[model samples]
Target: MSFRQGAPWPIPPTATGKVQMKNGYHQVKYTWPAAGWRYEARWHERTPWARLITYPSWRLDRTRPGKGYGPDAAPRLTETWVGDHWLPVSRLRYAAARYNHGCATSTDIELLKAAHPAAKQKKLPGK
Candidate 1:
């Protein structure tokens, strides 16, 4: 931990946590590397996107799918969830445009179940 002489606050250490949320057909876990930093926003994962990867974490997952990648841009899943619906897994970039609008959360699934009638009852993982 580090603190500034004049400031009353201490700089918190980097912490990590995992978040798994599902809305529509999208389900994935995001790892947060720093403490006290939680992503707060709305989120949608569109179909037809590709896997996204975050380095240092070196984790890989599918949200959509990407065609190619370079050194500077770490590989990331193509996102597709959007506006209370699940599209067929073929729309490129899925709903990449909307991701900047919000982050996803566990409660969104509750909202989705309230809106859509056919959502599969999810079983607890590892049960």
Candidate 2:
């Protein structure tokens, strides 16, 4: 699917080992190349009380030579996880938000189970 500005993060439908829970937040980090660009993303989420907050940051670098290249080559864009106030709503974040509101679908519940195993047993907000 297209990962546009308003679209969800590229979370695979199947289970993956990349998912994790750290410091009270669910996280997924990976890198991949697409259409001649290399991308690295660090996505994480936390549901404190009743709200789900997500930080999806990434950096994209040009892998192939292009006309837009200047004398000094550098990444096209870079966004770190820290100092992010404009939180965008990604697919993963949307799913977490739904779960927090007690309107989770099967896929959303499955994601929660994978990201936070404790959620399977406890009545957690992200679960």
- Prediction-by-prediction clash tally: 21, 2
For each candidate, what is the lDDT? 0.29, 0.41
Q: Which digits, one per residue and each the tens of the lDDT, describe model 1 over residues 43-71? A: 12332332321111111112433436676
The per-residue C-alpha lDDT of model 2 at residue 98 equals 85
- Candidate 1 local Cα displacement, residue 3, angstroms: 62
Whole-model alpha-carbon lDDT for candidate 2: 0.41
Mark the regions of model 1 whose C-alpha exceeds 4 Å error after superposition. Answer: 1-69, 84-106, 114-127
Best by lDDT: 2
Deviation (Å) of 103 in candidate 1: 20
Question: For model 2, what is the alpha-carbon lDDT of residue 21?
Answer: 75
Worst 10 residues of 1 by lDDT: 53-62
Report the lDDT tens digits of candidate 2 across residue range 72-99: 7654443222122222225446667788
Q: How many angstroms is residue 98 displaced in model 1 relative to the true structure, after the best TM-score fit?
A: 24
